[model samples]
Target: MTARERLRDYHAKRDFGRTGEPRGRGAAVGDEPRFVVQIHDASTLHFDFRLQVGDVLKSWSVPKGPSGDPRDKRLAVPTEDHPLEYEEYEGVIPAGEYGGGTVIVWDHGTFEPLSHDRKGRPVDFAESLDHGHATFRLHGEKLRGEYALTRFRTGKDESWLLVKGSADHARRQGTPDPRRARSVHSGRTLAQVAGNS
Candidate 1:
């Protein structure tokens, strides 16, 4: 399906009139795969993880943010496809709206799929995601090196685990204490961002 068609649920959940979020009307397929992590201060604070595929961004709602330790498995609940422009979204959603809260661009970067074939060739990222597993190397200001997402058996399709992979570039930056993390875009804390909105 086209990216526009894939964002039906996203559009349906948000009202552009009340929120400043982009209407997502003109999405174009990007040349390279990108990744974004947005710290969303909704009723429940969580991190929105997104990966570019085709013209849409496959997303997940990570409750405790991401970790840099291979042993740390963060719970990731899959969400709807978001528009590519949504990667730059960092503001407030009005009260009573679907995801009424403040948002901050925690990290934005490009990534390369690390899944490989039996012959040791890189496998398609989309295909890896379809098979419920994907390993990638992220090149971001704060997060570097390999990470992985693995879908565990759950009756619902949304359950997945975000894990850090052992890589030379991977550091011991265990999950940022959410309380102390600041936005990469604005250098503001979640409370500061929320109060300003």
Candidate 2:
């Protein structure tokens, strides 16, 4: 099973609030994983949202970035699932292409999900992303909390918000200040690393 494949499976049964809206490509239908997330600062200024599903990555692009708190809605737009290999995607995306600009693996790590279906067991992430609210219980050293990905609009995979819905006393329950999260690629920012690596 690939991420793209799983994404397709999840949607086959998803209500999506409407029909034929192209919310996602409805690729491979498979099981969505728990606590899996990857952030990619794209060729443009947008940040990519990726959750593990099957063998590929269920993806989206966030413009404002991830929130550390539980109140801020950091718009997350839905996008097609990229191969797991995409986790390593960095640099520029050519000058005249679909996304022509500089793409830096600004930061990369993992995230845990805490959302469940109406039954409250755990959400089958792959299929549930279309539900519009993805509750993530992050376990990463840098980001730890009960967070969420909410759909804010219906633009070109560039129209959603990654909202931090709630948090425990250990984590902020709202928006996180960028200064609080140090880059995870280690000591350097993505650009610095790309230049040197």
Candidate 3:
């Protein structure tokens, strides 16, 4: 198959995985399912975590940021998928970019959506989300397992809390900082990965 065809299949099959969006100049990437959760240490000092849900990536900008404590609920405000180029963005985003700040992929890894409602009946993605509980399993270097974010049906995008449900990955606040989170990438820190930014 041609390169474009290969990429299409890659995106189709590995639609959820996170890959470096080459910018300026870089190497060719592989084809595999990708799901990323970048703890971008931006100038604003907030963490940005994103996951490829379907076509467009699901995103969140967390301030005071991700606490490992399963009981501690962090605010996760949803946003749009920055162009794939954003995957590699670091340093300073010119003045017009969406976030426009120093970027750092604090932590990332592949994720799996957990199915079920509070009552434990196979819940659909849309249905669960509509009611304010999009639980899922995460297999990242830092965070993992049944997580939920109660979305405010009547409030603006500013209404959500990243909560952890009963799962294999649960701990205390800042117990596992993203900096300490082993990288799936080649021995490179998210900052180093985006350092060139």
Candidate 4:
């Protein structure tokens, strides 16, 4: 499906008139692939993990955010494809709107596909995703090192598992707690970004 068609579900759920989020219309981006982890304080706090695939941002709602521990397999629920400009979105979504609450750009940067085929040949990222698995390395500010997203189940909505690479390389450094972490883009906490602080 085309990227614009892929965003149909996303647009259907949200009321642009009630939220400040950008409409998933034409978004100009560079050739480099991009990734973003958005801290969304909705009814419940969760991280919106997004990777630029094709012309839209393939998204997953990670409940526990991402960990620096390989043993920590975070649950990632597949969400709708978002626009590329959504990477810069950091504000409050009106109360009656879908996913209404504060949003912050937690981490964002370029990513490289780390998936390979049986013969150790590099596999296309889209192909890897189609096969229900994708391995990639993130070079974001708050998050670094390798990470993998594997579809563990398929039902009403798809569910995936987000895991870090190795324990040694997964160890987090400064600002160990993600809840207390500030936005890499604005240096503001969720509360501050929401204008509640």
For every model shown, what is its TM-score relative to the native structure? 0.92, 0.63, 0.65, 0.92
Q: Which predicted model would earn the best lDDT? A: 4
- Models sorted by lDDT, best on top: 4, 1, 3, 2
- Please state the error at residue 103 of candidate 4 in Å: 0.3
In candidate 3, list every pair of residues with a backbone clash. 14-33, 16-34, 16-35, 17-33, 17-34, 17-35, 18-34, 18-35, 114-136
| lDDT (10s digit) by residue, model 2, range 1-197 | 63445557445543445322233433443343422233333354556667666666767667666766655667666676655555555444434444544444445556666668777788766556667666766555455656676666654544666765553643444333322333444444445534553
Error of 1 at 190 (Å): 1.6
RMSD of each: 1.7, 8.8, 7.8, 2.1
Considering lDDT, which of the candidate structures 2 and 3 is the better prediction for this target? 3
Against the reference, the lDDT scores of all candidates come to 0.85, 0.54, 0.55, 0.86
The backbone clash count of each candidate, in order, is 0, 25, 9, 0
Task: Please tell me which model should have the higher TM-score, number 1 or number 2.
Answer: 1
